[model samples]
Target: MELDGNALGGDLSSVFAADVTGAVFVCAGCQHSGVVASLRVWVPAPGLVGRCPNCTDVVLRLVRTPTRAFLTLTGASRLELPLD
Candidate 1:
């Protein structure tokens, strides 16, 4: 199913040490840039797959295991974290 990126807020914050919903991501595939919150997230997969809103390219994937959470940035070329 399709969900907003905010669905992974707690998981993301724990991994980033800050809220990542406001962070801007530049997709390498189509060069689309937007906040993570605006990305489309697929939750049915084994991991949370976040895609670029404009290009629909997979930008990130977040998988949480019992011991650690693995985050893979697939097509995101640049990430601009918010300045508090």
Candidate 2:
């Protein structure tokens, strides 16, 4: 079964100051751009992973602990977020 980016809502909201599901993510590997909500997500991984829909490249990674959360966007060339 496949899951969409919305599955990361609780996890993402914990790290970002704003709702980032609507943010645009540009894939570094294929230069494909899409909304965060549109990315494919894998929650069963060691952590949460969001991948580009067009190229199947990882776009974002999130790992959370009891007191800390780590987010990496190495696969994303750019992330455009809404101002409001």
Candidate 3:
């Protein structure tokens, strides 16, 4: 399923399912995307800290830190609406 920006908040367990090895966070504003390794850390929450691959913009990092499941999207400062 395509994850919309609005559906990003809350617990991210479902987003980082057991079978999901990783995920790519694509920026809606610039189409920048980044790959996140999902097996490295256990993500207690759904947020992270990084920059966009395409735009080099600071992203609101969403991560399952324990499993290393993570993604970086354009922050609310860069967008007009809340990401979730």
The candidate that wins on lDDT is 2
Arrange candidates by TM-score, descending: 2, 1, 3
Clashing pairs for predicted structure model 2, backbone only: none
> Which number leads on TM-score?
2
Candidate 1 per-residue lDDT, tens place, 14-50, comes to 7988799999999999998888999899868997889
TM-scores for every candidate against the unseen true structure:
0.93, 0.94, 0.33
Off-target runs (Cα >4 Å) in candidate 3 are 1-21, 37-48, 62-84
lDDT of 2 by residue, 1-84 (tens): 579988878899998898899889889999998889999987578888998999898899999999999999999999998997
The stretch of ten residues in a row with the least summed lDDT in candidate 1 is 5-14
Candidate 3 local lDDT, 1-84, one digit each (tens) = 223333333434455443222345545557644443211222333453444445645555665666666654444233322232
Error of 2 at 83 (Å): 0.6
Better of 1 and 2 by TM-score: 2
Local distance difference test, per candidate?
Answer: 0.89, 0.90, 0.42
- The CA lDDT at 12 in model 1 is 93
52 in model 1: Cα distance from truth in Å? Answer: 0.9
lDDT of 3 at 45: 35
